[model samples]
Target: MVGDYQTLKNIIEQSLLTALFQPIYDTEQAQLYGYEALIRGPSNSPLHSPIALFDSAVEHGLLSELELICRQVSIETFAKLGLQGKLFLNVSPMVFLQDDHPKGATLSFLEQYGVAPEKVVIELSERYVVNDPELLAQALLYYRELGFKVAIDDLGSGYAGLKLWSEILPDFVKVDRHFISNIDKDSVKREFVKSILALGANINSKVILEGIETEQEFYQLQELGASLGQGYLLGRPELLPVKILPSVLTTHQRKVKYGNYLDKLASSVFQHAVSFDSQTKTGAIVDYFTQHKHLHSLPIVRDQIPVGMALREEVLELFASPYGRALHEKKPIIDMLSSQPVVVEADTKLDEVAKLVTSVHDEQLLWHFIITEQGRYIGIGSVRDLLKQLTEQQLQQASYANPLTQLPGNVPIYQKIDDLLTKQQAFHFAYFDLNNFKPFNDVYGYAKGDSVIRVLADILQSYCTAEDFIGHIGGDDFIAIFVSDNWQQKADSICQHFDQAIRSYYTQEDLNQGGIVSPSRSGELQKYPILSVAVAVVEPDVERCRSHHDIAELASSAKKEAKKRCKELGKSAVYLCQRRGPDGL
Candidate 1:
């Protein structure tokens, strides 16, 4: 074979290797999550494929060298591309433990490229069994200490198996592609993936399905609630960073729409119940329940911590018998209390709470759940109230979500902004819209036009922090509230990614032409360029923009300026409104 030891050595010395990037998508967020850097030998060479290239290196005793080169080149190329999101770089366990391996070189390259360690996931293939598990574990700990995330690759098909998974407890586990192929029709594969997902959830690890090549596989994975995915169907390895496709975006939006209808529980729905000290006599509770007939349940607390609950029916039943009141009235209320009620944290989901309540076969279902903050009783939630709130939320989500993207509509957006303002919190409100979107709609028809909107929505949702809020203001208009200080960076990233992704929507001829011919309002033909996003950022002064209307007005002004700037510069742009001083606007 031409790819022998000598040829491999020559290739490494000449630096004939290059890197290709394939994107990984977060199905839940429907955004471009990150790219995995794949190494390749020179084109038209016998070592073009990675298998041949790496096998040769292993035979030549230069595997460590080749891996180092791959990493360095991958980092350099990724940085040069100015790609957003994480970079998944593969590392062989054997190569990783070599004495001559470049341990510090990775961190050095990242520093040189200004790439954060947090943005790189060190992917270790489970196929290579580690000779020194302790050393590898130490090395992995070092990587984690430096803020690098670790992922186990080819999990099910490898020798490492559960032993390695248990020992490492990696941040991510990549399911082997064999299970992902034709997964929609393979019940065995689907169940395996589901089990993996459950295991991942239990360990707080993210499961990334690899080598996805079909729409059915992707949809099935999504249906199984797999979050991270990478495969040819999502994107093929390319010299440059890959953008998420419109179809993926649309699928994500559909999933989100369905998820919105799922029941959600909010602690606010629980009513504030009167609580009595555990030391109080039964007579006091009897008198309170007698006086307040509307109270159904009462929390019995000790040092502000709920010890148990007293249901109205149980307490009233005791007083019904002539001798029962005299027999137990002098006893402490704690003695008469029912078995400790179900205690749920303020943020527990209703479905989970329902499960907990129903787990007991007895009459506990009728008991009110004690809601607590930091283990201290705050309120009580009845089954009726929980059911009602869940139904209301479902109805509200159905009505309040945008039909196209299924994002929260304008009403919720306004309410969120108003809530932040009421709390006197600082937030950056951004308005996003597509440049030359109408012409795109006219040329591409409604289906394709909706795809563009969904992409934008996905981008916003993906880039935003959990604390941030995203809402569709209808059609091409959208709003995002950024509570993080890095709002400008996020806005710029959204614009940049949108610009890169929008090109895929157009034909090669149209892209080469830089614009398309479409009819104007007067029935005359005009050239309209491909779609670009314009973002308007406004960091409202708390005192000045006291209402959602005030913030919207300022954002609208900034949006106009941003659109104007885009037109002038002939590209996407983000314009921030000048901030007001602390004194006043």
Candidate 2:
């Protein structure tokens, strides 16, 4: 026990708890909105892991001391690094209720360091429990009164997480890593995550999905409305002297090595196959494929089994063949098609599809291939039809996606805005622009600017909704149109999510530079104002005094007001601008 004391003391005094800042990105803006403060122990030490350090501290009856030290270190480190976003620090429930609680002292210490409770999010790790609901609620209320935000950590990691959420009513929920790690591969996980997101929505609690280490998981979570993400994929946990990731051949190479893929076939394809008796007419087969653009051919079956595929080309040939009359007459399509047809199961490897395509190219005639499940016809996939459909789909996607942000572009953006506008609903439009973005791009190479753009896109996509149209209007500009009867409230909610995501995505160096970097424009060090957003509210226009364009113009002007404040003050603050629609009599 004596030895343990000396070791623990040494560990705490030496600041053994090093921090790794995993980027929390906003899906809509694709920006670093905030960070989770992960405590890493000393290298080669028994307390090298955060779990180990905290557990040992708790066991040694030093949970409060350890947590307080972690909080101080995280704040000091963050201040020194010049980070502008929120800091998420883990706190055990036991530590929150320590008998000799130093909550007042802790709050004062943070204020001295210029860290406000509002910027310091206390992640409520369920490592310990509060048996009394009233006690827990009181503790949370105390924190809330101090402007401190509380989060329920490892949500969905244990039994009865939903119960915990209901009881705690936390300001945020950090989803367990298990659900995020393999989200792309498991439908159940995706559905489960979606449900959790929906729940968070109902409570107006922010959902910070943890442990996303792959692009597949990132995309999946973004689509499912995960507001913030933290994991190795966005940025790994590391000590200070945080470096903004560079754009280089090596960076590209690394992503290639660790890249994640969805499915081989695009998820949007629509196709279905049907089977018929061998005695079925050729005309019947033709009608089937003609009706479904995705279905390229029909299978000729015998005894509820696939005998062979009646290639579309075979039917076409019969129309031109000497037996053309038989095509429309009493002749069976099976008699004309090859009795022995190539068959592929639904789970067949992508390589197998390539091989089949190659083998068919050698044949005199070309046609659609049959897809089966356990030797039974399930669908038909034609190389030609696939090429055509995929091409059109890709084109459509390109148009919808913002060229700069790579988010769904202006088309969907306008569509969503129109829906709310037509309903005569009040909504908020948060317009964002990068101050000195062109100069930064001029210095850092267009590639770096592209990275920044992607970051912004990701932030907006993750935080907003299908109903909330997020649009990128080129060059450091983005617009989020959120429909809500209470526009100001919704704007506030979005702003919180946006701010957190931006702070999490960037490294200390990125933040310290004021988003400028060593790279220079015109050989001068590049500098930029603090990255921020401006919001404007456009209420329903019952008097019909303005057009959509006019309302949009008014919102744009309001955004300029926000930008002007950021330029003059150099501080983060929400500036709300409202235009009295025709409704103001």
Pick the lDDT winner. Answer: 1
Q: Residue by residue across 1-585, what tens digits does model 1's lDDT show? A: 537777788878888889999998877666778999999998888999998898777777888989888888999999999898899999878886677876688999999988999999998886666767777777888888989999888988877656767898999899999999999999999999999999999999889999999888888998898888989878889996545444665446545644544446648567877789999999889899899987778889999998988877888788898798889888998988757688888888887887777775548436678888888888888878777776776667645688777777867777788898888898888899888889999998999999999888877765775578788888898888999899989888888888887899999999999989999999999999778888888888876676887887788778899999889888889898885423335
* Candidate 1: pairs in clash: none
Against the reference, the lDDT scores of all candidates come to 0.82, 0.65
Quote each prediction's TM-score. 0.62, 0.51
For residues 40-154, could you state the per-residue lDDT of candidate 2 as single tens digits?
A: 7678777777877877887788777777778778877887787767888777777656778686865876877887778888777766666655676677778878888888889
lDDT of 1: 0.82
How many backbone clashes does every candidate have? 0, 38
Root-mean-square deviation (CA) per prediction: 9.9, 11.0
As a whole number from 0 to 100, the lDDT of residue 282 in candidate 2 is 72
Which candidate leads the pack in TM-score? 1
Compared with the true structure, the alpha-carbon lDDT of candidate 2 equals: 0.65
lDDT of 1 at 48: 93
Error of 2 at 509 (Å): 26
